[model samples]
Target: MSNMQHELQHLPASAGLEARTVGRVGIVGASSTGIGIAIQLLDAGVPVTFYEADAAALGAGLAQIRSAWTDTHDSRLALLAGTINFHHLKDADLVVDASETEGGEALFRRLDQTTKPGAILATAAAGAGVDRLAGATRRHGEVLGLRVDRAQVWELVPGRDTSDPTLATVGALARRLHAPAAARR
Candidate 1:
């Protein structure tokens, strides 16, 4: 199994978040973290819009998400069924890229062009750093990085330009999802 899959398997039960605070979220890639995070949010009543370039990957992701949720809250499957290919995230309060690919940086570049003005752009960039991702966009203050490991901890790594609001927003999201985030670094 992939390293990401291992983390997903151990994902803690949800504390759920305020739907209004989260509003809408857009997630890129059908990766383990992306799918797992989506399931967590949907179960908590947050509306999520998923974007994927490939149809097959999206299908596999949706299937995995459905299986994970259907056993508990079958109704959530309907909410997770929505998937779009185009970058129509103008409404997403947070656009997170959970993909662990080397192409992750490139996706960040595209997000700048597509995401709306104040929306936060988050990536699971591991140790690659979020500078490059933050630099690609005009709203550098909102770019952040997430690091999740098999040890069952999450680290919210902020870039030089990341603003306090961005940090606070992600920190709240992490808490709501029951994923404790490490101290800002």
Candidate 2:
């Protein structure tokens, strides 16, 4: 099995999240992390929109997803979309920054400005701390770090200013996505 599939299989159980906790999800970048996350969320019937400045990269990423999808291609594709416009993320309830490039503060600041208030912003950048990312955003309470390790464990790191509600929401989301081992830090 693929590494992504292996990781998905080992996630922990539910965190008592509502069925409709996540209305929509926005992903920045077309990296492997972003595509893996999209697969998991789409399988749970959540709509996912991918934003990439490079149209070619976006297309490649979409193609990669299609190729990796072994079943339920039509339904998953129905819930997937790709865009070059960053503003389109305004409607996302959860925005994950999985860009391979090191955008740092500029990226988080822009994401904070573009997304609607109350939206949760997460990073798939493994070594990037939640506090650093949150420091760049106005929605400090809504910023966190989410990363899946090689062993299939998920780490949900909250910043100092991260609100309890945000942590709960993300925990619920992790459950909905079948990531049972999501531990908060």
Candidate 3:
């Protein structure tokens, strides 16, 4: 069995549910940041779906993942998927937008409409970008910024309207991935 399967097997049913509150993470962009975050999530037994506007970029991202991962078990690999369809992210509990595409405001607005209600929306963009992105979404309370540093620590940056519960949920996810979290206003 793969390491991910072994880890999942040791987890109780309740533990699984609790830890996976942000189940099935979706990442926008096939950028290096997106790929790195995908690796971290997959290593933690979290299913990851990647959305890329460019088909070629999506293919390249998948290739990068396969090449970087030493443990290429089919079962563990099954947890990763790629899509060009924006709607495919509807089922994702958390979405981290790492794309450097144009019209970021439009994209965030689309994400607000496409993602399921209560789904946590995050951006890998720096500075007050999260606040700007949140302004495009109706679900301001559920939107924040997330990025993994070189130390593998997750930095959770909140917008003006970000809620405590949203931070808690993402914090739980960081812990599940065996990464510490730093909160930033």
Tens-place lDDT per residue, model 1, 46-103, is: 7788777788888888777778743755776656544665557667888878765755
Q: Residues 1-185, candidate 3, lDDT per residue (tens digit)?
A: 65434433432232323333888999999988888899889889899999998999999999998777677675668899899999999999999988866437788899889989989889886653777888999998889888777666677787888887787778778778877666755
Residue-by-residue lDDT tens digits, candidate 2, 1-185: 75435544443342333323678999999998888888778878889999999999999998887776677547778988899999999999999999999777899999889888888999888688788889998888888888865543456777788776776677767656766544444
User: lDDT for model 1, on a 0 to 1 scale?
Assistant: 0.70
The lowest-lDDT stretch of 10 consecutive residues in candidate 1 is: 11-20
Residue 62, model 2: Cα distance from true site in angstroms: 0.4
Q: Of models 2 and 3, which has the larger TM-score?
A: 3
Give TM-scores for every candidate, taking all chains together and pairing residue i with residue i: 0.79, 0.84, 0.85
Ranking by lDDT: 3, 2, 1
Q: Which numbered prediction scores highest in TM-score against the true structure? A: 3
Against the true structure, candidate 2 reaches a TM-score of 0.84
Model 2 spans with C-alpha error above 4 angstroms = 1-20, 70-73, 150-153
lDDT (C-alpha) at residue 165 in model 3: 78
Off by over 4 Å in 1: 1-20, 71-73, 150-152
Q: Name the weakest run of 10 consecutive residues (lDDT summed) in model 3.
A: 11-20
State the lDDT at 110 in candidate 2. Answer: 93
Q: What is the lDDT for 90 in model 1?
A: 63
